[model samples]
Target: MAPKFFATRAHLLVCQGQSCQGRGSALLYKALWNHLERQSLAYYKKGGSLRLTESGCLGACSYGPTLCVYRPKPAGGGLEEAWYAAVDFPLATRIAGAAHEETPLPEEHRYGPE
Candidate 1:
């Protein structure tokens, strides 16, 4: 049996693959954490929490500095995924803020789905 997890509403996976790293994912990861902290989006926070993770390759090597956000829908509505490709510092901050409900997802940065 697996241990019970905390109340998490969403998860952000920042690719740390060699390619993505070379494009600045490491610095982006730190920036995301800091931005989330300033916005009170700690993973352990009560109610809806936004968790950040350093992920391995997401199989989009060409899209370096990529990220994916996983948000579970309510009432068995399944999961929601949003992929952002070729991210820069400004877009990364927007992505983090969206996870915390501070802003809407930037469609311009979105790489998958509508």
Candidate 2:
């Protein structure tokens, strides 16, 4: 059977591979969940639109504590995807807020599409 999907505005997939975890991605993931809890957007079943998930490697192990965001594009134009690297706690909070508000991700400490 196919897995069911939720209608989430976006999902924050934090890298939890060996490299990212070594760089404290686990803490970053926890921090994001905390922020999501505060905003009441942590669970899709609870009528929330934001989701926090863990991923493996993401093929950018050099950039530990990395994360990716996937959301729908405008005009039903498929999906928009972006991967970010070198994410720390302070920046993680900013990202959480931006994702929750459907705003642009921060420009600093984020280098991707390579």
Candidate 3:
């Protein structure tokens, strides 16, 4: 079956691969869902705003626990996607908030190994 688009063309892909799981990716995924739900209720009010997709590893295993935000652009314009790595609870929250606001992902927050 085709995937549902809960909120236009924006999507938040959470990685739940083995490496990420060991690094507490599950907790991050839960936090993202909660944040998205709360934001959707407050804004959309009808429930179901941001679409959450649980994905496998997004490479960057060195970073582990990664997520990518897919933001579709206007007609004919290329879509914008950002991959975040080394993410924890706080980082995921921020990402979800940005996605909820339909804003671009911040550069400073892009994660990776030190």
Candidate 4:
């Protein structure tokens, strides 16, 4: 059978690889969850659902505690992903707010396209 997938407007992929974990990815992940829950945008829910995933090694070990945000194409094409580096709790909260509000990410936090 084919794999099942859930539709969402945005997806946040937090790197939890060894390097990132050592650099505090776990705390970042927890902060993100708290922010999302406060915003009422839990993963795989109904309306305003934003998918949150823990990713392995995004290949920017030097920039540990990295996160990638993916927004689905409105015109039915491929997804758009952006990378953010050296993220902390505050930045994670802002990222969650951006995804919740359907707004662009803050310039400082974003690294570039991933």
TM-score of each: 0.82, 0.82, 0.77, 0.82
Better of 2 and 4 by lDDT: 4
What would the per-residue lDDT of candidate 1 be over residues 1-114, giving only the tens digit for each residue?
998777776788999999999999999999888877776787765543788999999888888898998887655699878898998878877776776674457786677867
Q: After superposition, how far is residue 66 of candidate 1 from its true place, in Å?
A: 0.3
Clashing pairs in 1: none
lDDT of 1 at 17: 98
Across 24-100, the per-residue lDDT of candidate 3 in tens digits comes to 88888887777767666222347544667789888877786888877676464877778887887777777666666
Q: Which ten residues in a row have the lowest lDDT in candidate 1?
A: 39-48
The positional error of residue 65 in candidate 4, measured at the CA in angstroms, is: 0.5
lDDT of each residue in 1-114, candidate 2, tens digit only: 987877778778999999999989998998888877876787554757788889888888888889888777756899767778898878877776676677877777677654
Q: What tens digits encode model 4's per-residue C-alpha lDDT throughout 1-114?
A: 987776667889999999999999998898788777777787555555688989999988888899988886657798767888898888777776777677877666677873
Our tally of clashes for model 1 stands at 0
Clashes of 2: 0
lDDT of 3: 0.71
